[model samples]
Target: MKIFLAQQNYHIGNFESNTEKICCAIDLAKKDGADLIVFSELSVCGYPPRDFLEFNDFINKCNEAIDIIRKHADTIGVIVGAPDRNTVKEGKDLFNAAYFLYNKEIKGIAHKTCLPTYDVFDEYRYFEPAYHWNVIEFKGKKLAITICEDIWNLGDNPLYRICPMDKLMEQQPDLMINISASPFDYTHEQDRKAIIKANVVKYKLPMFYCNGVGSQTEIVFDGASLVFDKNANLCGQLPMFQSKLEGFVLNDDGSIDGPIITQAKDVPDTDLNPIGLDEHLNIADIHDALVMGIKDYFGKMGFSKAILGSSGGIDSAVTLALACTALGSENVRAILMPSQYSTGHSVSDAEQLSKNLNNPYDIVPIKNIYDSFLSELKPIFKDLPFSLAEENIQSRSRGNLLMAIANKFGYILLNTSNKSELATGYGTLYGDMAGGIGVLGDCYKMQVYALAAYINRDKEIIPTNIITKAPSAELRPGQKDADSLPDYAILDKILYQYIERRQGPNEIKAQGFDAALVDRVLKMVNLNEYKRNQFCPIIRVSPKAFGVGRRVPIVGKYLS
Candidate 1:
C-alpha cells in the first residue's frame, strides 16, 4: 500500500490560501500514485481559530474550503480535519472531527474522543465529545482515524477521560491515521514519537501521524509527521515546522519501511533571518504565517485593515512593520501620535521607519487629543499634585485616538506593548491597552530589539535611530523608560526567569539579585495578573506566553 502524508503549514483563518496549498499537496500525492493521503487537524480553517469560529461567516467560509477540496476527491483520497457541527438538540454546537473524503463524498466523521482543555487549549469551551469509535473499511483496508488530541490519551483532564486505543485495537484495523495540530516545545517532538511507538507496538498495526505547521496567534503548530510499524520501530519520520510530503509503502504483512521524503529539502544553515512569533526555519513559511494571522484576524473579525500608533521605538516599529507585511502596505495605517513631550528625533525616526517599511502612515499629532484630556480633567483636580495619573493620561489619549480611528474605519487596533513593558505595570490600562490584538506581547523588549536587528541583518529596514534611541513613552518631558522602570537589560532578565522559568522570588534572589529588588520585581509580576488578564491576545512563542497557557487567578495571594 502506498500512503502519502501531507505535512502542511496552514495560516490561521486564511481558508482560501490554505485551500490552494492543500490542493497542491493532493496533486502531488496523485502523481506519486498513492492510494490515500492524510492531512493535519483543522486543515480546512487552520487550527485554533479561537474567536474566529465564533463567527457564522468564518465557519461558513471553512465549509466552503472543504467543498473546494471535495471537487477533486475522485483522483486523490484525503483524510482531513475541520470543525463539524452536530445537528443535535442538546449537545455542543461544534465537534473536532476528521473526514474520509473520496469520490467527492465524505465517508464519515471520525470525532475526536479526547478534547484537551488544559493550558493553552480550551476545547471543552467549544466542542462536544464523540462517543462512538468505529473502523472505516476503505480501499481493501480497515482503518482507524483520529483527530489531534485523540492520540494524546493521558491525564484525567476535564475535557474527556477515556483512551480509545485499547478498544480500537480489538477490531484489528489494518492501519491507523492521526490528524494533529500538536505544537512545538523544544521537547514536544520526542514525547510524540514515544507515544506513536507505544501505540503501534500495542496494536501491532501500521500508523501514520500527520500534524500542522505555521503559527496562529500565540500558537505555532510544528508539523512533525511520523510512521510506525507493529514492532514499535519508526519506519519513517518527517521534520517539524515545514511543508513537506512523505510516502510509505506497506508490505503484504502490513509492515512499513523507510519513508521517501519528497517535495522538500534540508534547511540551509546559511539563512537565519528575523521572522515573527510563529516563525519557522524557512522564510516563505514564516512570511505566510504572519500574513495569514494578520489577514485572518482582520478578515475573520470583519475588518479590512488595521491602525497602530507607531512611536518609532522598537516595539511600535516592529508592530507597524509586521502589519505592513501581513496586510498589504495600503491596508495598515500608522499614526505618529506625538504629544508636546515627543522628541524631534522620535518623529523623524517614526517617519523614516514608516517609509522604509512601506506602510501607509501619517502624523496625527496627538497634541490636540493630549490637550483636550488634560483640559477636561484640570477642573476636577484643580489643586491636586501631579503624579503617574498625568503620565497615564497621555498614554490613554493616544490609545483613544488609535481606537477611535479603528472604530470609525473598521480597522483593528494593534497594541505595541512588548513583554518587558507588560511584565511590569509599564502599560497603561485603558490607554495603550486599547488594541484589539497585540502583536509582540510575549516577546521581551530585548528580544524585540534582537528581532529588529535580525530583520535588518541583511538589509537595514529598521533605522539605527529607532534601534539605539533611548526607549521612552514620551508621556512627559525628558521621559525615558528607565525613569520609572529598571533598564530593559535587567528587567527582561528578571522576567525570563520569573515568567518563563517559573522561578519564585527566593529562587531568583539566589542568583545574586538584591532581596529588595527581587521582592519588588516579583511583587510587580504577581500584582499585575489582573492587568495581564485584561490584555489582548498575545502571540505564543515561549512555552509560557501570556495568553491562555499561563492562567493566574486575579484574586490570588500567591506571592513569590
Candidate 2:
C-alpha cells in the first residue's frame, strides 16, 4: 500500500483551518494514487488543546471536523487523530483516539493506550487509557497504530509497567504507524530517532511516524516525519519545521520499497532522508528553532509588530535580529534607552545593529527619567547609599518607555533577558524583564554569544563591538555583570547543574566547584522563584526551561 505522511502545522482550537489543511493533504494523497494517508496526533483540534478539551462544545466541533474528514475519505484510506467522547459514566469523559476511515466509512478506532502526564503533557486529566488492545484489519493488512507516547514505554528501564507495542505485537500486525505531536529541543531530534529505532528493533517490523510541525506557543514540533525498514534503516524522512505530504510504498513483508517524498509545492520527488544526527547537534538548529518559535508565536497571536529595548548588549541585539527575521525587518522596532551610566560605544553598537538589519529605531534617553524617580524618592532614601534600588530604577525607566511604545503602537515587547541572568536573579523585576514574551529566557549567556556568532556567520548581522563588549546592565558606572554575579563561564555551569540536572550544592561542589560559591548560586536561584513566577512566557529551546517545565515553590526553603 502507498501511504502518505502528512506533516502539517496545526493551530489549537481552530477547527476550520485544521480541517482545511487535513482535507487538502487528503486530496493531494489521493491524486498521488496513495492507498492511505496518516496525520499526526490531535490533528483535528491541535495538540495540547489544554483545558479547551473540557468544553463539550469543543468536542462537538471536533466531531464536526471528523465528519467533514470522513466525507473526504473516498477511495483513499485515512488515519487521523481526534478526541472521542467516552460514553461510559466512569473514568475521564474522553479518549484520545485514532480513526481509520476507508471507502467513505469509519472502519475502526484505536484509542491511545498510554497517557503522558508529566512536564507539559496532562493527557491523563482528559483521556482514559485503553484497556483492550486490537490491531485493525485494513486492505488485507493488519495495522497496529499508536499515539505519541504509546511506543515510548520501551527499553531496559521503561516509564510504564506494560509496553503498548508488546501487546500489539501479539496480534501479529503487518506494519506499525505512530502519530505524534512531539515538541522540539536542541537535543530531542537525535534522541527521537534513537527511540524510534529502538521500537523498530524491538517490534521487528517496519514503522512509519507522522509528527506535527509548527510552533504551538512555547512548544515547537520539528516535523521530520520518518519511516524505517524492519531492520531499522531509515528509508524516508520529511523536512524539519515544515508542512509536507510524502508517499512511501510499503512491501508485504513489513518493509518499505522505493519511498518517495513530495512536498506541498511543485518540488520534484526526492529520495533524500534528512535525519542525520549531526543536523540536530548543530547550534544553527537551535537558532532556527527559536526563529520559528518567534514567528509562530506572533503569527498565531495575530501580532504583526515587535518592540524591544535594545541596550547594545548581546541579549537585546540577538533578540532584535531574530524578531526581524521572524516578523519582517519593517515590523520590528528598536528603542535605545540609554541611562546616565550608558557608555558611548553601547549606543553606537546598537545603532549599527539597527542600521545593518534596516530595522526602525528611536532613541529614548532615560537619564532624565531616572533623575525624576530619584528626586521623587529622595526623601525616603535621603541617607541611603547608591545601591541596587537606584540601579533598578534605571532599568525600570527603560522598561517603562519601551512598554509605552509597544502599548501605544500595538507592538509586543520582547524580553531580552538571557537564562543566566534569570537563573541568578541578575535581572530587575518590572524593569528589563517586563515584556509580553521572553525571547532568550531559556538560552544561557554563553549560548547567547554563540547565537550572536551564528547570526553573523554569513555576514555581520550583529555588530562586532556588541558581540565583543563586556556584558553589562549599565544600571551604574563600571557595572560589569561579573561584579554582581559569578563569571558566566562558571555561573552557567553551576546553574545547569542545579536547574537542569537537579544537582544539590554538595553534589555540584564535589565536581570542582567552590562549596561557598555553589551554596550562594543555589540560594540565589531558589530565592528568586517569585521573580521568575511573574515573568513572561519564554520561548523554550532547552530541555529544562523555566515556567511550565520547571516548577518551583516561591516560598520554599532555599538550598534544599
Candidate 3:
C-alpha cells in the first residue's frame, strides 16, 4: 500500500482556509495514487483551538469540514485529526481524535489517549483521554493510529499512566501511523526523532509520522515528519519548517520501499542541560524558526510592514536582520532613537547595519523629548537626584516615538528584548519592553550573540561593531548591563536553571553559581512576572518560553 504524509501549516480558527488546504493535499495525494493519506493532529480546525473548542459552533464547523473531507475519501483512505464530541456526557465535551474515512464512510476513529498538560500544552483542559483503544483495518492491514503525545509515553518516568499504543498492540497491528503537532525547540528535533524511532523499535512495525508546521502566535510547529521501517531504520523525513506531502510504498514484507536514510541508532542518554551555557546550539534551526515566526505572525495577521527601534545593540541588530529577511527589507523600518547618553558610534553602527540590509531607517534623537519630560515632572519632583525615573524617561521617550511612527505608518512594532533581560526585570514596562510581538524574548543574551554571528555567517550583514560592542540600555550615561545585572555569561545560566530547568535557588547554587547571586536573580525573576505578563507574545524558540508555556503568579514570592 502506498501512503502519503501531509505536513501542513494551519491557522487556528481559520476553518475555511484550513479545510481548503487539507482537501487540496488530499486531492494531490489521490493524484499520486496513494492508498491512504495522513494529516497532522487537529488539521481540520487547527491545533490547540483552546477556548474555541468550548463553543458549539466551532465544533460544528469542524464536523462540517470532516463531512466535506469524507466525501473525498470515496476514492482513497484519509486519516485526519479533529475534535470529536463526547456523547457519553460523563467527561469533557470533546476528545482529540483522528478519523479514518474510506469509501465515503467513517471507517474508524482513534481518540488521542495522552493529552499533554505541561509547558506550552493545555490539551487536558479541552480533551478527554481515550477510554478505549482499537486498530483500524485498511487495505488488508491493521493500522495503529495515535495522536502526538500518545507515542511519547515510552521512556522511564512516563507522564501518563496508560499507554495507548500498548493497548492498540492487542489487535496486532501491522503498521503504526502517528499524527503530531510538535512545536520547535532547539533540542526537540533530536528528541522527537528518538521517541518515534523508539516506538517503532518497541512495536516492531513500520511507522509514518506527520507533524504540523508554521507558527501559531508564539508556538512554531516544525514539520520535520518522519517514516521509520519496521526494522527501526529511518526511511524518510519531510523537510523542517515547510508544508510538504510525500509518499512511500509499504510492501507486504513489512519493509518500506526506500533506501535506508539512517540505521536505527541508540537514543542519546545525555540530557540537554538547560543550566549550562552550551555553544553548540542549533542556531540555524532557531534562525529559521524565528524567521517563520515573524513571517506567519505578519502574514496571518494581515500585517505587511514592521517597525522596531534599532539601538545598534546585538538584540535590535539581529531582530532587524531577521525582520528584513522575513518581511521584505522595504517593509521593515528602523528608527534610531538616540538619547543624550547614546554614543555617536551607536547611531552610526545602527545606520550602517540598516544600510547593509538595505532597509529604510530614520534618525530620531530623544534628547529633546527627554528634557521636556523632566521639565514637566520638575514641579512634582522638586529636587531629587537623577535616578531610575530619569533613566526610564529616556527609554519611554524612545518607545513613544517608535509607537507614534508605527501608528502613523501602520507597522507592527517588533520587540528586540532578549530573554536574559526579560528574565531579570532589567527592562522597563511600556518602554523598552513595548512591542506588538517579541522577536528574541525566548533567546538568551548569549544566544542572541550566536544569532548575530549566524546572521553574519554569509557576510557582514550586522556590523561587527554592533556584534562586538559592550551591551547597554543607553538610558543612563556610562551605564552597562553589568552594572545592574551580573555578567550575562553567568546570569543567563542561572536564569536558564530557574526559568527553563525549574531549578530552585538551592539547586542552581549547587551547580556552582554564587548562592547570594542566585537568590538575587531568582528574586528579580519572580518580582518581574508582572512586567513579562504585560509584554507581547514572544516568538518561542526554547523549551520553556515565558508566554503560556511558563505560567507563574505575579504576586508569588517564592524567592522575592
Error of 3 at 383 (Å): 1.7
What is the C-alpha lDDT profile of model 2 across 444-524, one tens digit per residue?
Answer: 888888888889989999999998888988888898988989988888888888876777788888888999899889999
Each model's TM-score? 0.77, 0.95, 0.98
lDDT of 3: 0.91
Prediction-by-prediction clash tally: 2, 0, 0
lDDT, ranked from best to worst: 3, 2, 1
**Model 2 — which ten-residue stretch has the worst lDDT?**
263-272
> Per-residue error at 408 for model 3, in Å?
1.4
For candidate 1, the C-alpha RMSD (Å) to the true structure equals: 6.0
Model 3 lDDT tens row, 1-560: 99999999999989899989988998999998999999999999887789999999999999999999899898899999999999999789899999999999998999999999999899999988999899999989999999999999988899999999999999999999999999999889888878887888788999999999999999999999999889888888999999999999998878999798888865433345444656448999999999999999999999999999999899999999999999999999999998889999999999999999999999988888889889999999889998999998888888999999999989999999999999988998999999999999999999999999999998999999998878999888898988999998889888888887888888888888889998888888998999999999999999899999988999875788
Q: In lDDT terms, which candidate is top? A: 3
Please identify model 2 stretches exceeding 4 Å from their true place: 259-281, 558-560
Better of 1 and 2 by TM-score: 2
